[model samples]
Each structure stands twice: as structure tokens, then as C-alpha cells.
Target: MRLRIVVLFFVLAVGFVLAPRAAAQSPIVVVSQSLDMRFPRSMRFNIETKSNTRITVLRLTVWQNGVAVGARYSPAFAPSQHVRAGYNWSFQSLSEGGYLPPGTRGEYTWHIEDDAGNVHDTPRAAYAVEDRLHTWQTLSNDVVRVSWYEGDAAFGAAIFARALSAREFLAKQLNIQDIRPLQIFVYASKQDFFTALPPFSAEWTGGRMFPEYGVIMINFAPENSDWGMRATSHELSHAILHSKIRGTLGDLSVPHWLDEGLAVYNETSDHAPDDQFERMFQLAVLRNTLIPLRKLEQRFPADSEQAQLSYGESYSVVKFMIEKYGAEKFAALLNIYEKGAAPDDGLRQVYGMNQDELENAWRDEIGARSREISTARLPTLAPRPTFEVSSPLASPTVLPTASPAPTAEPTRIAQAANPAPDTAVPAPAPALPASGLCGGVVMLSGLVALSALKRRGGRDSER
Candidate 1:
């Protein structure tokens, strides 16, 4: 009987040892997470894991404004001696495969699978990635608003006027009367400006429009104030075009050429016929490289030089339509787009001509020959402010305000136009926690940076 008791005790001890592992399998502990906007294609995340585990699949999926932009996956490994696996990230080697555009916010989650086939998932947390160098100052009216840094209040006022004035003119020209909240972000420097953009954004791009969010990001250098406002007007034209179209039509997509040409035509200044555009335009004509107007409806050339020439061609073609056909016809063509009519059908209905005839007439009028045309799918290039169009309904946006004191996370301007209700994707079933693993988790952020400054009060006491 004593021997039997001993055997039973041994079995009980073994069961106790294995019971915890079988009954409760806690998720992987998140040590820290961050995204360096400088490299938008990569995600830097750290995790705590068991020593014996090998991470076979580590995936990250990002959802922007409720739209799943894309996902990136990687293989990662961790050491048992050190519980921390530092910086396991998915590098976006493909052009559009894992690219994340800047000046946007999204919810991202980590999905991890271990060598033993155990799976772990993190809750989708909201993240806004934009420039956070200085505290912002905002100036607003009913229809339009502007926000800048402390010393840029004057620039903000100037841009405010520019935004409203351009809005009035575009609305009158388009024969539309509707309002969408337009928020402008004015960064103080070029580096700060680039910091707010995706990697492939062009160097010459001074401003961009996010129609999905109804926001504009512009680099406002005090030294180049005049040119900065011009970019402001240029981007505002795009904002007006996109917002008015959405307000009028439910959610119709427009062509690139018409979209860009109208934005360019609204620019405050005009160049001579033989100016900057002529150089690239004439070269494309000499080489026979201009994309057909119908083909250009999709995108321009991937080559920057050829792309600029495409812009010139688009502007010239759009300008010809306006001059020869008149703004009334331009409005009518927009009406067709607003109605979601087919592009060629709209071309035939509005202008009584096909795209080929239109392209030939425009090229002939410009006294230039057409180029060797290729129909390859062009990667969406910079300065075009390419993005997936969101629903016309606006989601309740959060505009972040920062205090003089340090913040754990940079404040964001969550302001949205025609904001819609939030929609959250359901997460996977969570596993029960291991005994000690159920303890508190701390998020690593900028809250611990030490700050000390000497000061003298009015009473002459040093502080």
C-alpha cells in the first residue's frame, strides 16, 4: 500500500507540472512597438518570447481609415537566455506590396506563429504617423481652417485667405455649392515636410492632398513664402475638386489627366508657351513618347522626366479643351464623371470626339508629334497624391493637440470632412494567460526623457 501511495504521489506531481502548460497558453508579451516614418515600408516591433520557441511566421497587417492597405510577413527567431527579441520587422522589398503612405493613420496588429504551431495575436491599436517637431497653432473659419507652428501664425493667416479664396473661385467655376471641412498642415521646414510623406514622394512636391481624410500637407518655408502659397493654392485646387465631386456624386473616381490638369490650370501664375513645360514637351514630341489621352486616364509615365512631360501634355490638353470648348463644357464633362459614366462614353457625349481624336487635335494644335506609346501599368508616382478613395461619409476624426510639456505620443490632427462612424475588425479568440505572464505590461514610449532647465523667478529664487 505504501508503494502504491508513492506511485500515486509521483503521478500527481507530473500532472501538476504539465497541467499549467496545457490549460493556459498566454499570448506573446509585447515589449515595444514603433514605426520610423523615415522608412515607411518597414515596421519595428520587439517581443518577449520563450527561449525554446522559433518564430516561423510574424505578420503585420495595417488598416488605414478602415481599409486594409496591405500586409507584410517575416520569419523571426528569439533567444531563451534573453527574453527580449529586439526589432523584428517586415521589410517592404516590393514596390507596392508592403508600402505604407505617410500623413495617414491606421490600426495595426501583429500575428505570430511559433515552431510548435501555437499562435498569438495582438489587438489592433491606432497609430498616426506624422511630423511632431513643434506644438501647432490653429486658425479657423466656418468653411476653411489653417494650422501652423507658433511663429507661423502669420503664414497661417495668409494660407487661410488663400484657401477660402480658392474655394470660392473653384466652387463658382464648378457650379457647385457644398462644404467639407478642409484642414491644412503647414510644416516649418523641408525635412519636416518630407518627414510627413511616404518614401517615393518626389522632391519637388511642395504639397499633397489626402481626399480620404480631407487634409492638405504643405511645406511652408518662411524664406519661400510666395512659392509656398502657390503650392497651397495648387493643393487646394485638388481638395476642392475631390471634395466637391464627393459632395455632388456619392463616390466617383476621376481620371488622372483631368484631375491633374485642372489642378495645374488653377495655379496662380502662367508660364510662356516656350517656358519650363516646353523643354520636356518638345523632347517627348521629338522622341514620340506621349501616352495616349485615354491611356493617360489611368496613370502617367514612371520616368520622372517623361512624367513631367505627361503633366505638361495633360495641362496643355486640358487647357486646349477649356479655351476651345470653354469652361461650360469642362463643367459638363465633370458632371459626366460625377455621374460615374464611362470615360470614353463621357468623352463622346460631352465633346463629340474620341480620346484618339482629342489627343491628335491637342498634339496638332501644340505643333508637336506624338511619341512611341506604351500601355504598361505605371507605378503611382509622386506629386500626384495617389491614394485609395474612402467612402464619402466621414469618420469621426481626432485632431491631436499637444501641450508644452512632453507627450507620450505625438499629437495628431484627426479632423475629418464628412466624418463617418468607426468600424473595427474582430480580433481572434484570446488564450488564457500563464500564471506569471498575467502580470502588467508596460508600453515603451517617450515618457521617460529627462528634462531640466534653470530659471529665476520674480522673487530672485533660482528654479
Candidate 2:
């Protein structure tokens, strides 16, 4: 009876000590639900301990299609403290072996284990397969290629090709095919583009145009803004123009008006400040500073004031030429100018009109329109604000009259009648002496008289 009592006490003591260890080794329980998304999406799982007991070692094993794919673990934990949480695992359908066939279903399961080697299996997470478009990539050059981010490959490819074709056409027109091949960057979302160029702000304007390097950066933010197309076309036009005139004419001093006018003409979209043109026109008409076309090339209103006028006039002039001369003639004019010919000469060669005549016509058209608008019932007129016109570097050439172009057949004339795009006055032809004879005629006569006197003296000596 004494031996039995001693053995029973020893066993009870051992069992008491082992019970706490067994309880501390209990498995961790994990719960999870399958992810569902209406649109293509991404998900992250956050695992956290709810109990105060520190889990010394906790691990999560992920299974996709019955195969172990990824695992995440917690850092070392101490008693009575919830341990470090983690989210270092991810599964993408596009990843290899992660994709399921369309109309088929698949299951994902997560298993949680604790330091005691106890395992808890989560309920099966279900997912369905859906169709996705394969993105297509086009190598623009050795360093760069365009790829579709979200749109259909066919549509993206079409837009890319169209941009390239347009650039090529402009280059050929400007005779600058040697410019480095330009790369086009297309993004599917504004957020993706934010990584490149920041969102447009009115204060932040202007872009780079490096014809020598053959790169053009286009920010398609505010994806719907016409400014994007206009800016792209404008920069590309500069590239084409630069490539053509790089080394010619001792720096090829193209005036701002001509450069910007050509850009506006080629742009397929309108800019945000387009309405400013009509406003300037009305103001100029009222203020009597509406510059005549003849004088436009030589002089402009002061800086900001003239900038508005210059743009308005350029748009109107280019529009008129396209309407009157037709697209073919307009294109021919550009071709001629791109070939190192003076703009005035190119215009005269193509249009058969002098700068003076064109200016008069433009002024008359504007004046007539203004008069007609005034005659019509004017809306409750708002008091027009008076702002000082920025003075131009030089006074604009004034027109003698506002008249339309002559309807009669053009007369063949020797002098160029057209003006440069920036100058209203026609460039004077190389000057000629008043008389047909060269300036040396008087000297030649003096030489003849001296020769005659010498011959007479020689005759006397012979006598």
C-alpha cells in the first residue's frame, strides 16, 4: 500500500507539469474567404493575431490548384504578446500555372500552423476564369518600343501606326527624313502617366522639341484634352522644320509668328485658348489696333497683347488660304518654303498676290464682320475691360485700305508681291540702278576723254 501511494503521487506530479506544456502547444486557427472582383483587380491578405498569447512561430501556407505556391511567416513572438503580422504573399492569375481556363473553376486554400506543429486548414476559396486580351508590343527603336497597357491591341496598334505615318508625312514635307526616328509612348491610365509627366497646370506650359536627338515626349494626361493633340503636332512640326532648316540661312532665323502659325495650321485639334482669338479680334477691332495682314509680318502689338493678335491672325490667315487656295496649293506652298525658299517668295510664287493686297483683304473681312455683328441686335453688352496692348518691337505696317483680292485674272509681274508670314510689308527685291547702265558709266566716260586727248597729242608729235 505504501509503494502504490508513492507511485500514484509521482504520476500525478508528472501529469500536472505536462498539462500546461500540451495546452501551450495548441494549433493556431486561421479563417479566410475566397476573393471575388467584378473587374480585373488585385488583393492583399492581412494576417493578425487576435489573442494576447505570443505565438512563438506562426506560418501560413497557400495552395493554388492543389499545389503549394507561397508561404508567409511571423517574426519571433513572446508570451502574452500578439506577434508580428505579415502580407508578403501574392497570387496573380496571369502568373505561370496560376491561370485557370475560361468557364472553369479553381480552389485556393490556406493552412496555418503554430510552433507546436499543429495545423489548421482554411475553407476552400473559389475563383472563376475570365478572358483577357493579350497585350501587343511594337519596337519603336533599339531603346524604346510601344506596348498596349489596357486597350485592345488592334486599336492601340492603329493609333500608333497613324501617329507614325503622320510624323513621316510631315518629315517628308519638311524635307527632314534624316531626323532620328521618334518614339511614341502610350499609357492606359492617368495614374500610369503620372509617373512620367505631372498633371497639366496652366502655369506649367511649354514642351521640349529635340530634332537633333530624335525624341518627342507626349503626355496624354487629361486624355481628352485637344491640347494633347495640338501640343504633340506642334512639337513634331518643330522637329520636322528644324530638321529641314538646321544649317541653312545662317541660323535660319524663323520668326515666332511663322513657326507657331505653321504649327497651328498642321494641328488637327484646337487649343484651350482658342476662344481668346475671337476676344482679341473683337478688342482689336474696337481699339483700332487690328493689325492689317500686310503689316502683320513686320510688326506685332506689344508682347502679350500681340501674342493673342498674332495667333488669331495666323489661324485666320491659314484658314483663309486653305479655303481659298485649296489644300493642294497650300501643301505646295509649304513644300516650296521647306526647300530653303523665302516665305515671301514662296507665297508669291504660289499665290500671285503681294503682302499689301493680302493684308487689305484680311482687314476688310474683319471690319465687315464686325460691322455686321454691330448692326445685328447686340446682346446686353458687357463693359469691355481696357487692358494696355503690349507694344511690339517695331510698329506694325499699316494698310492703305481694306479691300478684297481682285477677281480679275492675275497679271504676270516681275516683283514679288507676297510678304513673309511674320512681316506685313513685302521684302524689297534686290535694288537696281535708276538707269540701265551700271554705276561706273561716269568713270568710263572720263577714261574715254583722257584716251582721246592722249591720241591727239601723239598725232601732234608725229606731225
lDDT of 2 by residue, 340-438 (tens): 455456566777754445555556665633221223432432222211111111111222122212212111122122212221221221111111111
lDDT of 2 at 269: 30
Question: Which candidate number maximizes TM-score?
Answer: 1
Top-scoring candidate (lDDT): 1
* TM-score of structure candidate 1: 0.51
Worst 10 residues of 1 by lDDT: 435-444
lDDT tens string, model 1, 196-249?
A: 554455444446666444467776556555655655666777765665454321
CA lDDT of 118 in candidate 1? 59
**Candidate 2 lowest-lDDT run of ten:** 434-443
Candidate 1 ranges with C-alpha deviation above 4 Å:
1-132, 150-154, 197-206, 244-252, 269-275, 282-291, 367-424, 427-463
Overall local distance difference test of candidate 1:
0.53
**Alpha-carbon deviation at 283 in model 2, angstroms:** 4.9
lDDT, candidate 2, equals 0.40
